[model samples]
Structures are given as C-alpha cells and as structure tokens.
Target chain A: MKNALLSIEDTVALIASRAILFVSGPEHLLRSLPRGNWIGGTTSYFMTPEGGASREDRLFCTTFDDAVDARMAILPPNGLSGLIEHRFAHGFTCIVTPAFSTTLQRYAVDGPALPGLYNQPVFGWVAGVHLDRVGQDVPMVFDGATGAASADGLAALWVALPETAEVDLDIVNLFAPGDGESITFPEGGFDVTNCLIGGVPTNLAHYIVARGVDTTLPLVADYAGAMVNVSFQTVDAENGRVRFYAPVVPGTIYRLARTVADYGAAYAEGAREGSAADMLSCNCILNYRYAELEGRPTGGFVGPVTFGEFAYILLNQTLSRLSVRHALAA
Target chain B: MPDGGLLPSVDDQLWARLLTGELDPDIKTLATRLIITRLRIEVAKDSTVLPTAVQELRRFFVENKFAHRDLAAITGF
Candidate 1:
C-alpha cells in the first residue's frame, strides 16, 4: 500500500521527463530557452524569506511537465479558453514562450508585457490539479491589480487532457475502527491538531459546534451532510518545511463530531469506495485557512508544480483505495 | 507701480540672454550634459531609468537649488 502511494512520485518523475522533451515539430525550429522567460509550462513562482544577501528572497520552481502534457494532449469538451479567463479574473498572470508557437497568437494578452511581471510569487495549486486531470493546455494570465505591490498572488495554468483519460475519486481508510471514536473540544468548542501531510506541517482540525434551538447544550454535528467534497494541498516552502491542509464543510454539525484521524480514514475510505474518473484540484488556501481557524502562524508561499506531477501524486497516493470504476484501456 | 507689476518680464530677457550667449555658460553646459546622459541611460536600460539616475537628478537639484517652477519646466516631469 505504501509503495502504491509512492506512485505519485513516479508521476512527478514522468512529468519532469516530459518537460525536458523539447522535440520541435516539422513546422518550427527549436530556439534557445531564454532567461527571464517564465520557464515552468503550467507552473508559477513564489517567494520565501531568507537571511543575508538572499534577503530579497524568492521561492523555487519545480517541474511537472508530464501531467501537464497528459492534460493538454486531451482537449476538454468545452475547451480551455473559459478556464483561462476564470483564472485571470482571480489574479493570475500567464506567459507563453515562443517555443509553444507564435501562430497560436490570437489568445495573447493585449498591451506591452508589464515590467517586473514575473518577479512575484504565484499560488497555482488548483490549476495544477486541473491540468493533471485534463490533457490539453489552457491559457494562463496574470492579474495586475491585487497583490501587485507586494508580489504575492495566485496564478492558474490550465491544459486540456485527452477526452479518453479517466478522472475519478479514490478513497481509503487508514484508521482502525476505534481510532477516531471520540473528539473533545477545548474551551473554544473545537480542538486543532498539528500534523504533517505530504511532508508539510498543518493544522488538521477545526470546526464550529452547532446548538439546537430546543437544547441549551451544543451538539456534535455530522460533517458528511454539509461537505460536498474535501480537498488537501501540500506546498514546499524554502524554510525546509512543507505546509498542507484539508478543508471540509464549515458552520455545520459535522465540525463537532469528526477528528483528524477520522477524516484521514474517511479519505482512505472514499478512495476505496469512489469511482476513478473524478478530478481533484487541491486549493492552496486550505493550509492557511486551517491555520487561521487554529490561531496558528500561516506564512509561506506555495511553489508551482506541473499538472502531471499533481496528478501523479494524487493517483499514486490514492489508487488502491480508489474505487476503480473504469480503467485506462491498454 | 511699474507696468506689469514690479517684476521684470524674465522670459524675454532670459531668451535674449541665451541668444546673446550671456547666460551662465556653466549652468547651460551642466543642463545639456545631464539631459544627454539621461537619454543615453534610458535607451540602454530598456526599462525605466534606474534609481541611481533619479538620485543623480536629486543631487543636481540640491547643488543648484533652482525654484520649483524652473525645476519642473526643465525636467518636463
């Protein structure tokens, strides 16, 4: 089971391989990959604090080309333009290098390329997940308004996936039957537990207790009814620690009843019971939101990973427990 | 009061002085040199002129202490 989860690492490796695969088609010749051009195809950059001369600190970029290619290779039914527009409105900037071909020019942003555009850090976890599921590239754009002064913002890069590729939800149960039996709240009605997920330290639990109108006492809520879905995101910061979290329904009954161990078990169980075709996009804000709920320090940037790497991580980590309704045809 | 208030019509007088090469030659030379240097640096940077250029301009202002209107007119800011 552990080995299976490491398959996400394989997905990361595969995507890295694809990023270096710079074969030019018959129509165009390959040119030198220039400095200052944003290099990560579907990835964005972020910053981290540092000491000494590195005081003007910045985040590092990781390659995830394999999943990006898989998603872009398979065009989504509605196309990627709408997704691109959606991300732009959310304050992401997209840059396309000449290697992707200048003929695909109609979608380019108008006005001269803004100076110091790439100097800021990008938050792109959601888009990276989407590209991993789909196989084709979506247009990326940056928003100039919000966080432009501080150089802290989010960007989404989309790529279309093959119509044939399957996206499904997989769940597995990692806890024993009595592992998460009872959860007690501190004076505040919710207890926050700090734990590590995907190599990141995160606050895993926080919920509001709901009191029924009739009873003066607060009652434990059932979170399952309130939550449509759960998302987990892990980001590596330059500070040698990764930040991560899982978000569920808020202001609902489930907040009082569930434990972090219970949630993990549910996640594993979901993999065991659900189909394999649904795609997941882990929100980058999940960790910060968790920290906010727990009154913990939440400061750090989420670095960019290609779509392929995200998918690889998702699929490998949850595959066996994943309810495999359909299989990729050999 | 004299015609057109107590102040002289300095614009015409300054123009005449410049035409006659009677204005301070050192100030003219410094202004011309600064303008040419700024233009060349602007072209080379291929972006906004660096902070150093702005600092240099401020240093010139401190040394000469020109009137606000004159400085504004000279820089065309």
Candidate 2:
C-alpha cells in the first residue's frame, strides 16, 4: 500500500493508472478528480509526515496495491444495509458517510443491528468540513466510479483481495470508563433529555452542569471488552437536553471517561503499537482539536483527521486503523 | 469445514437462543447485538460467514461463560 499527500496533478495521474484508492481532500479538490477505481470524502485536515496541517490543494490518498478487484458505489438514502450485500467475501470494505446526513444518523443508531456487519473488515470515516466553516460548508463524499459527489450519500469501496493477502481492522482508544455513576439511557439516539444515573432518573444536561463534568470527555461504555465512546457535542442546560457525536444505546452502561493529562504522550504510546506502514488509518477530528495536533506529529500515525472513525461501527474520539498484509509462503 | 456449509445442529440451537435474546441478558450491548444480528442472516442462509459466526459465538460463550445449561450443552464452552 502507498499512502501520501499528493498534488491534484499527481492524484489525477494515480487515478488514471487505475489504482484502487481511498482519497480525502477539500471538497473542490475531491470534485476535480477523474473517475476511476477510487472513493473520496471531504476533509482538509491531515496528519502528514511533517505534521498535522490543513491543505486545500493537495489530497491524501491511500492506494490498495494488493487488491485484485474493486467496486465503488454510492448507497441510496436509508440504504446502509446495501454495504453488507456489496461486501467481498475475502476482502475488506471502506465506507465514507457524509457528516450530519440522515444516513450517518441512521447508521449511528441502527448499524449494530445490520446483519453481516461483523463478518468482514469494515472501516472508514465520516467526511467533514473545516472547523472554521462548520455550518457554512457541508460535508460530501465522492463515488469516483462516476465522478459524482453527494452531500448525503454513503460512499463505499469494496475491494477483493488475493488469497495471500490478509486485512485486520481495529481501534486505538485512550478513554476508559471512569469510576463514576452507571449511566444508561431509556432509548438510543443522538439527542437525549433524560437518562438513568445509577438507576435514578435525572436530566442529562442538568447532571452534567451540576457535577461540573468536563464536556470534552466522552461517555465511555464497555462493548464486550472494547471501550466505545459517545462524545459530547453540545449541552443545552436550559432545555435539559444534550447531544452526542454518536448515539447512546439503551441498556448499555456508560461512565464518563477518565481524564488524560497529556494527549500527545497518550497518542504517541498508542501509535507505537500500530503497524504504521501498509496501514490505512484515520484519527478523530475531536482529537485533532482537543490535542492541538496542528504542526504536531502523532508518532508515525498519519491519515485524514476525520469527524468520526469507523471500526465495524461508528466511533468517536479514537483512531481507527486497517492494515493489509501479504502472508509469506511456507 | 467448508466456509459456506450449513451451520452444525449445535450451533443452530445457539443461534436460535441468540434470536430469542437468551444468549445474554444484556442483549442491547454493542457486541451482543452485533453477534446476534450476524447470526440472524448467516443462520437463515448458507453463507461464507457461518463458520466465522460459529467461531465467534464459541469464543464469546467461552469468555462470558453464560450459565444456560442448554447453551453449555450446545457449545460445551
């Protein structure tokens, strides 16, 4: 695999070479690319070798050189399950859903119920606009097969791998459930007005304010042995409501994450365990902002700083990496 | 041992229990929900994921050690 930030001319040439690619760049640059075996999402922030930087002219591209066959598609509205049917039996799938779209919300809430979701290695991110232009600019994903861009469609690339190739996908999360109340919601959703705090009904927004809880820290839950996070988006104390980047599922016990004193050190420690080469990875935009990653290196981890990371399911405030390797012959 | 073969009878019992939310009381947990959902499709049809489903369930059952006698008899985990 080859991962790098390239000029529009170089990216165009790479696409013309018919290379299977996962591209991330500014919306205009992504829209300029020619049709080929590639899929793209809008994002200007990237973790480059030099350091984290937001560039509009260059595109971050990861080419899957070992993939023998590839198919790219844009899923229709409320059609996330279409990805399951499009999976390659022996390979992995990369998906890019536009941020704040109905498809993204649906996937956040209903993705766990999607059949065959765990049968294959599925990973990707929610495309996002620059932080400076949050509401003024919209996130978009591209189906490179048709040179088409959609603001709300879920774009996916399904690649068929050779027998010798193996793909593994996982996440690097720095947060763990803090020693606090066992929080649970009555229903699963992105917005919440009421929740059970240690089995006592409490207003979520009021609880956050009353306890002086740091909104930057996400609510963490143990999914099997994995620590999943639902990052806080906004707190409307007057209305007794709160919003989260990912949905909080019903019956899932949660606690606010333990504080990390140093973000750079934690990520660096996590990066040391990752296989930097031959890996297609992405970090959360929240991490980029909270850690002040601009011009700072995350050890060897590099890719787009996405709005949200996908490892089987949508994740928040985490790093998702997918590595493809070729097995040695006996 | 083929990838797409019909799941063995023992696994079918586990799959049935999973469908009925008997595999784990906390069925709403992300992992349990995913495991059950996957089995729902792979069990209903012969697919390459059946073997994977069986292995994952065995691993989960072994780790959690669900106290269901029927599950223990079916999986021996």
Candidate 3:
C-alpha cells in the first residue's frame, strides 16, 4: 500500500471511498474528516516521502489495500489482554494511545505480563501534540468508524489479511547496551528512585549525574535478540528521582546505550536494507529531534514520527515497522 | 520430528529451561517467547499457573515444528 501525506479534501475523499486507513494529523484537521473505516491519532510530525515534515494542514495516511477485512474499536482501559482474542484470524493489530496518559502507561507497564499478547503482530505509536503545546494541549486518538475523539481511550484497528499473506512486525533500534555498569530496578515503573548499579544500590538520579550518562541515549535491554529501549524523560536530581518514557521492567537488566556519532546516518544505514513495499513504519519523536531528521530522508522507512513506538510492546527512541508479504510475492 | 532436523532431546531440554525460569526472557527463541513469557507471567501470579501453560506451549512447539536449532548451541544444552 502506498502511504502519503494528503490534504483534508483528499483524505476525506479516500474515507468516502471506504479506504481502511491509519491516519496521523493535527487534532483540528483530523476532526474535519467524515466517518469511515479508519483509525487515527494526533501528530503534526511525520517522515514522508519527501523526508521529515511537520505539517498540521496535511495528514499522513496509510491505506491497507491488501487487508480483506478491518475492524476498529475503543479498547477498555484494561482491555489489552484481549487484544489477541479480538484480532483477525490471520492478521495484525494497530494500536494508538495518547502519550503521557494513564492509558499509555497501563499498556506499557502491564502489556508484556498480559496473556495472549504475543500471539499476533502488534504495531503502532503513542499520539502526541506539538512540542510547544504538549502540556497545554492533550493528545487525542480518533475512532474514525464513529468519528469520536478521546484522549484517555485506547484506539485499536485489527486488519485481516488474506490467508495467503504473512505479516512481519519488527523494529530498527540503533542503540545497543553499552559496556558499562549493569542497572536493575527494584520494581517495574516509569519513575524510579533506587536501582542496583552493578549490584550496588544507588539513587538513579545521582548515578546519572555522577556517571555523566547522556539522557538522550536510552537505556537498552535485550529481549530475545531484540534491543528494547527506555528513554529518559527527566532526571530530577533535586528529588533524587529519575523518569523514563518507557518502563524499566523489574526482571530486566538495562545499561546505557552506546553513543552514535551521527544519529541520522546511523538510522538511515540501519534501515537501508529493508524492503519498502507494503510497509507500515514509524519513528520516535526523540529521534526526529535528536537526529535532526527534519527535511532529511531516514532511509526507506517513513511514516509518522510518533511520541513512542510499539512492536508487540512499548518502546522509545526506535523505529517500528510492519510489512505484509503475499504468497504470490513470496 | 521437528522441522529443522534437531533432536527432540535438545528441544525438550530447552523447553524445560524456559519453563523453570532458568533461561532469561531476553535470550529465548522467538518461537517460544510468547508462550514462555505468558508462562512466566502466570507463574508469577501463582506458582500453580504452570500446567495449563505447559500444555499450550508443548502444543505450540509441535505445531510449529520448532526445534530451537539455532539456539541449541547458544543455550549449551
């Protein structure tokens, strides 16, 4: 499916024509669309074919033309466990949750522990507002089937592919656990005060300062060869507390990510080898900013530059991608 | 027989390691990850939450013909 950024009129025409879509745009522009078979979230930043872009007037639209059937729903606050149960027989699920909301946190902290989550491919991102209006304006996700928008609700779209089609969900993470002190948290949560630094209990905030850790580089944990990242949101040295964009699971070991001299080039190189056909991809907002990806091509993968990414689980500072391979193509 | 021509003994051993929490989730084979992760989650809630998960996971390995061939050497079993 060819994904592109389109005007409200164009997006509306596609919706009117019954295109099953996952859309990303500003709140005002998204609210203008007529109801149809689609789901959406608020985001003004995107990585379009022309490279990085931040446009409120246009919306990034991904049409799942290969999907045989699509269903959209507003998942209950604790409905993540049933994600696979509601999924199509042989397809994937796209989920959108508002950033910094309890809805996102619930999924982040409890998703991996929930049953039946790993049965299907799940891919999507956290809805976010423009950086200037983050605190002033709340991020919103739209249930295009009903044209209803809500900040606290989780929006899910389950797309059914043909029996002959196989879908793959993966991520391109440039960060690897650096060779430094191993860190472990006492409990799993976004906010942390105490952690074990190389088997020695220490305050995370003080450790970050004393060790000169770069907050931009996330803490990396290896999950079955998949490098998952939990990015730093703030280091409250005054309170001796540290906050992360994603939760650091209790049983996991985390280490500071090795520094990348050039984030854009590194990301581009990392994504260069992947096939771009029938691909749905999204990058993190932190990468867009830190890598200075605005107006620059991030290799072949392109879509919304979201607040957070999901590849079966919540992640930060990474590129999440999903692609469908039809039997004929294989 | 598993698809990759690996021995059933090696697969069973790997399965035992995963079920007993002797293997780290980070190093688990993808084919067994979900089942093992769910098993870990259930076992954490109650030690008795093992039998059902074990049956389900065994079925998964057979249905998928997963031998954990690539990981047999890495896991050193």
DockQ of each: 0.00, 0.11, 0.29
What is the per-residue lDDT of model 2 for residues A173-209, given as tens digits with 9 covering 90 to 100? 8789999989999877999999999999999999999
Q: Score every model by TM-score.
A: 0.24, 0.84, 0.88
What TM-score would chain B receive for each of the candidates shown?
A: 0.34, 0.39, 0.54
Model 3, span A1-330: residue lDDT tens: 668789999999999999999999999999999999999999989997667889989999999998899999878677776677788877889999999888899998778656556657789999999998989988999999988898987899999999888776677777889999899988879999999999999999998898787899999986556677899999999999999999887767789999666665665655445565247999999988987789988777778999999987898999888877777744
Better of 1 and 2 by lDDT: 2
Report the number of the highest-DockQ candidate: 3
Off by over 4 Å in 3: A260-274, B1-11, B18-77
Q: Which regions of candidate 1 fall more than 4 Å away from where they truly are?
A: A1-151, A169-254, A260-267, A273-330, B1-77
Q: Which lDDT values do the candidates have, in the order given?
A: 0.24, 0.80, 0.80
**What pairs collide in candidate 3?**
A224-B26
lDDT of 3 at A58: 94
Would candidate 1 be rated incorrect, acceptable, medium or high by CAPRI criteria?
Answer: incorrect
Encode model 1's per-residue lDDT on A177-214: one tens digit a residue.
12232332221211234433233444333211121211
lDDT score for residue A47 of model 1: 16
TM-score of 3: 0.88
- Give per-residue lDDT, candidate 3, residue A115: 57
